[model samples]
Target chain A: MGEAIVVTSGKGGVGKTTTSANVGTALALLGKKVCMVDTDIGLRNLDVVMGLENRIIYDLIDVAEGRCRLNQALVKDKRFDELYMLPAAQTKDKNDISPEQVRKIIEDLKPDFDYVIIDCPAGIEQGFRNAIAGADQAIVVTTPENAAVRDADRVIGLLEKTQIAPPKLVINRIRPSMLRNGDMLEVDDICQVLAIDLIGIVPDDEVVIKAANQGEPTVMNPNSRAAIAYRNVARRILGETVPLMHLDEKSGVFRRVRKFLGMG
Target chain B: MNGKSSITIKGVKEGLVFLLDDQCDFVTLLDELHAKLDKHEQQLAGPLVHVYVKLGARQLDEEDKERIRAIIRKQGNFLVQTIESDPVAEEAADYASYRLHTVAAMVRSGQTLEHDGHLLLLGDVNPGGTVRCTGDIYIMGALRGTAHAGCAGHEEAIIAASLMKPTQLRIADIISRPPDEWASAEPWMEYAYLADGAMQMDKLTHLHHSRNKVLQAKGV
Candidate 1:
């Protein structure tokens, strides 16, 4: 049976859709047939990130409402032969479809794909519920900020109610300089707050923004740090042991020496 | 007044209220009522069954009421509702009536565990999670959330945990110190209680050193 994984972050702009796009792409590159489902109805962005926005003819709502066949709504990605995406509807309200409807659509697509990645919407509302309805696993993305971590804590708490066994954590947009200067939360701090297993640590990279603007996920580029980190995340999901990305290695020996001394 | 006063029934717009006689033999009257209810079971069966089974109109304490509620639930067709006349008065009356609720699962963030009596959590309470109780709070695992030990104004209630690093801690009314820096180490078991109207926390070792004093205060 294919596994459905939901990439979610309770706080907005914390790289949920980004993670979903990259992870799904990486899985497809790993030779597994993957499908990316955007459950962020009413505020869709996954299609654009994957550079498949213009190719969308029918969306998830269309398939759920029986307006289109399940395979008819799946937009194939040009980059990978095995990769597909089901875009969310931008014209309807989030409440138009229920979690059961989303689950049914994913169930219909499960047998044909090896992995299904759902790009969840922000907040723990109806949209979030729909994204997680058919998910066998969850990846909670959060930043080092206190507010974002607090929301991540809440989202993890909610995910516990559904018994998503040991959901992994992804800390995104982390600045190593800030951590070295003792100005921001470290990975350990976030783990202490949210007692979850660490899966991915994406650094603050301008390449990701550039790729997003060009309607491409950074994971498509092998040279991008974020792309490498996401590939590591995809590997971890496949039960591989990958060490955490070294996020504190900045330029300059003076800063490195200072960091060594400040490691109290 | 009828001599047979073991049971009196009154009709309300919503449903019915049955007042049991306190002077009669309790078990006998209960069995009799249970037998009486069995005869009319089909007539009362419905999606909604609302009724009041007051142990004593105004004198029954919280435990008694709870026991009566349990009995009503055990009956054929009745949804027991304990009508509280005054929240304050009933709370005051229920001050000494407490229960020890044991939950064997980790309390996650965004989730809340609220109880009218003592709460014993078998797992860690993560950050951003809140565990509120009217009486004492005990956590078998780590404590990293907001915990209100005496949520119902019971200052004597205490909170104890194996690892007590809370984001926020409250004893009765006072909010304790802010969450401490995240330490990636196994902290010793800690306990939180009130002393001189202020919250005080101590490691289990120190509390064990002053066992007489700590025990005296703990029983308060």
Candidate 2:
């Protein structure tokens, strides 16, 4: 059976859709047939991120409502033969979809794909519930800001109640330079607060924004640090043992040195 | 009152209150009533047996009512008592004491929930929403939000739900996270409680088993 994963972050603008697009693409690149579903409904962005916005004819709502067949609504990505995108309906709101309907759709799609990645909408509402309805696992994306971490923490708590097992954490938009200067929250700090397995630690990168604007997820670019991190996260999802990159090695050394030198 | 086996338990109220107990098999009760009517056939020469077993005109909660109804169903339509008031009063009292308390329509940012009692959330507690309750936290729906139970440090506090996932969890400081490799998609009713100074989860497969056993053993 295919793995149905929801990329959710209770807080808005925390790179959930971005992570979904990239990770879905990455997983597809790993030879896993992947389908990315945009569950945001009215405020859909996953299609745009995957550069498949203009190609969308039938959306998720259309398929769920039986306006179109599931296969017909699935928009194939130009980048990978194994990758498909199911755009959300911009006209219909979150209420247009039900959890049962979403679960049915996922069940229908599971046998055909290796991974069903859902780009969950911001906020814990009808949209969030729909995205998670049939998800086998969840990836909670969050930034390092207090509000983002706090929101991530809350989402984690919510996921626990689902009895869906613990959702993994993906800390995106991290600034290693800020961490070096003691201005950013470290990965360990986030892990301590969230108390979940760290799957992805994406550094703040302009490449990601540029790629998103171009309708291409940064994971396609092998040079981008954030892209590499996302790919690593995808590998982890596939049960690979990839080691975490040292984003703040220089600053970590300085801190150790400072602690070693107890005297002036 | 005029019937042979009619036990009339009275109050200021109108009609008879039927007492249902688990002491004898329901067949035995009905058979005894039938036999009593047969013995007094001359005194009460009615074709049908009218054996009214009245317990009392007592109010009960929904749970108690369900229990009573289950027993009544097992007895199967022989014993009939006219209740002066609706049996619903007991349901009202029971529900009033433990009606699920759903939080505000939205659990917004920077808000913390510290409830001494059960927390029934109708909506989601978006990320950054913190809840610390002394009793169980029941999110009627999804709980991808953070919740900490046993805040007063009660280890007995259970965190249960239809869908469960939390970022950070502490059941009386016995901190444990979900298995890193667990990504199963099943709608399960799971409870987390402190076991051996650690958090443990168990499937709530026996909803009525525990209470039923206790009641049966207590001879209630």
DockQ of 2: 0.10
Interface RMSDs of all predictions? 1.8, 5.8
Q: List runs of model 1 lying over 4 Å from the truth.
A: A250-264, B1-104, B115-122, B177-190, B208-220
TM-score for candidate 2: 0.56
Q: Give Cα distance to truth, residue A9, candidate 2, Å.
A: 0.6
Error of 1 at A231 (Å): 0.5
What is the TM-score of model 2 when looking only at chain B? Answer: 0.45
| Candidate maximizing DockQ | 1
Best-performing candidate as measured by TM-score: 1
TM-score of each: 0.74, 0.56
- Cα deviation at A128, candidate 1, in Å, is 0.9
Q: How far is candidate 1 from the true structure (C-alpha RMSD, Å)?
A: 10.1
Q: Write the per-residue lDDT of candidate 1 for residues B140-211, one digit (tens) a residue.
A: 988888899878788878888887778888987888765342232445777887888877776666665544
